[model samples]
Target: MTALVEVVRSGFVESVHHGSLVVTTPDGAVRASIGDVHSPVYPRSSNKPLQALAMLRSGLEVADDDLALVCASHNGEPDHVERALALLERAGLTEDDLHCPPDRPRHEPAAEPRRAAMNCSGKHAGMLATCVAAGWPTADYTDPGHPLQRAIADTVSEMIGEPIAWTGVDGCGAPLLAYSLTGLARAFGRLAAGTGTPRRIADAMRAHPWLVAGTGREDTVLMEAVPGLLMKGGAEGVHAFALSDGTAVAFKIADGNARAREPILVETLRLLGETPKDEAREAVDRMAVGAGVVTGAGRDVGSLRVTGAVAEALGTGS
Candidate 1:
């Protein structure tokens, strides 16, 4: 089945979000999907955790607390910035070692007063620290063929149970690879199952959640919602999540509607027997309706309509 998120504003499709998804339990059972679960796709920010796991094995001296930051797509808040800065300090390095170009903070409007918290900063800082620890040159750190990049690429390949056959540049100028949604889900399953997730990787994320995402971000919220659950969302309507109990889900919006993400996300979670609390459900509901524009100027307008054979399997739609 396929779907597109419609912008009620102009009743037009601003983006295309067509892709498959796979829901699997830690025990390795396939649960449900809406499209081609085995279709290859880029992992995006969702790959951070895998990169961090490789860093652990590469002999990087990052503490568990710092490991979390390494795997995070932070909100670039003051504290998030401070931690990223501190990571640089700890490695006796600085941002110059980072090859990722700077950009505007991911969260604006409310946090407009402070501009330091760009989502990629923490990841960049972690990359810089790794370069320092490895005694590798910081120049061209973003090079796809760089030693660090190679290590991460290999790590990602190993996690997915398939060799990466292609590469592309990411929004932050790092190497990006394609993999089937099942491959992505399997990777998360490995992490959640702690099969391939290094101690450093898990400890870092579990110990310092805030560094993973400042005060409140979806990554933080999901992790908080399901304690010990490692979650990450990528740009272009992609999200990856793993329950410590062994369930994992990977999805992409065929039409890249960030709004559709909420219901799909909650729906996926609910399939895993997770029923969000009133507050959490409400929060997800808001995103479902284009960020709090739910309920007809005051009604519950949040929803998703799963159709076709895939929907037949799931048994529901908007």
Candidate 2:
């Protein structure tokens, strides 16, 4: 692993985060890398877009906005919950069909816990809808041996151009496939290249960024601010994105610290020539501020910043 970010308090370095990152060209060639980008790691929810593509390939059909939700790791807000429920209803199913654990809104405390309110409910709903469309069994949709899951695994493997290194249960209780950051970046490059089914999934996400995540979320905010940028972040500090030109990036923080993610992402995007537009500059700036300030007695003292290899790559080395 390589040092990727630092937490500075009172102008002193207090903590450091290590991670692997890979940048791929439009043709999926490695442009640059730090750490073990070739090793397999569970991509978490970063795999959603690819999974949505797999569902589409399996005959699942939905409106564009609904498709975006199908690829979501939503904030569990009212609109998000309602949309997931609506998808289930369209498939003649209900929240009970969802295997994801019941949970409340991540950003809304007052909401009651329910299966539909779980962040992964949209994905579960999509899986169920795919089952209905493909004549597969919905009750066992989350099972690794289920046809829907098998199809997803196959699609993921095809897109990444490699067999999955391992299989595990995701937080949503669905089959999770592991692959290298390079492979993940390549899959996203193909999506962003705007070709067939993958293009449809990527366009839906780019068209409905809010449904892809939610208000104030990093994925939503960044997609909105950066035109033609299809991005997704996963648990355990995984993140991946592709530019309209097909340039792609994928990374994982070795320590699984979410706070280090944005700083590294922002710097990496800047290094790759992304310029936030004027209309959405403020929002992008807020995200770019990153890990925020460290304070002493409620007064700002220091701040977290990109450092080490990532910093040097951004030409802002400490």
Candidate 3:
């Protein structure tokens, strides 16, 4: 099948393999994508919202404002650092309590704080707090069977409306469930418009868009522009979103190229009726279509497309 979906190039091709996705409200489903959306690829930080669901289940009762940090993949700007610290303090914990790796800030070139954008940091912090409230052990908080993570997996499964078929270690050392792209999309859609856990989590992300990503982040900007949108992006060319109405989208770049993010994201937004066709095109244009790092000298990689059973799933009501 000539896998390793390379974006065509002039006299050469580069490997950029990664998954992508889009999901919409009322059902959380797949509208479009490439590669194996059904594969249980590690969702990375995109799964933060699901993790937040567990904190609530654990009786943390975090204010709506703090919900942003709980569900963010922040840039680790000062504000993000301060908020994360506050979250830890709120739980009667401290920076020493954080279990994620230490790293430079995620927002960058702006004297960003350390590891704040490690999106999982806030989630981890929240979990630690939950443990504190429950008096559980903190040393292995990242373990899948840990009370917090155990609850997180249950919540994730319920949101996706299915049992996880497989599991993997995420970049942040948490359990990553193997989920279908359509299922992942539908899970977000539920957050955007479904009842119970879905709507509760979606509301938190929308109400605190800043906490979902960071200042000037495309996901943050997109949510703000679209209003009440459900969106999240994973590392390695993975993205997903849910419209307030019934729309879901997902994509995986055969080769993981950051340059492919905008076009694919905008395209998915357009498909969900969240963006004007031209606006989508412009967004993709900003991705430097033929830039040296992307496609070679003069070749245009094709736009993202979605197909297969997942298409039928999204089309059912998306």
Best by lDDT: 2
Residues 107-158, candidate 3, lDDT per residue (tens digit)? 4655643554566677777778888887788888888788877888888888
**TM-score for predicted model 3 compared with the true structure:** 0.79
| lDDT tens readout by residue for model 1, 1-318 | 465343343333343345567777675567776667776777788888888877766667766767787788777666777777788888886655555666556665454433235577677777767777788777777788888889988988888888886799987777888887777887887787674455346556756767787675766665656566777788887888877776788888765556556555655665556655566666654554455433357654443433233344455542
lDDT (CA) per prediction: 0.69, 0.88, 0.65
- TM-score, one value per model: 0.83, 0.96, 0.79
Residue 215, candidate 3: C-alpha displacement in angstroms? 3.0
Candidate whose TM-score is highest: 2
Off by over 4 Å in 2: 291-293, 311-318
Clashes of each: 16, 0, 28
Descending-TM-score candidate ranking? 2, 1, 3
Better of 1 and 3 by lDDT: 1
Q: Following a full C-alpha superposition, what root-mean-square deviation does model 1 have from the true structure? A: 3.9
Better of 1 and 2 by TM-score: 2
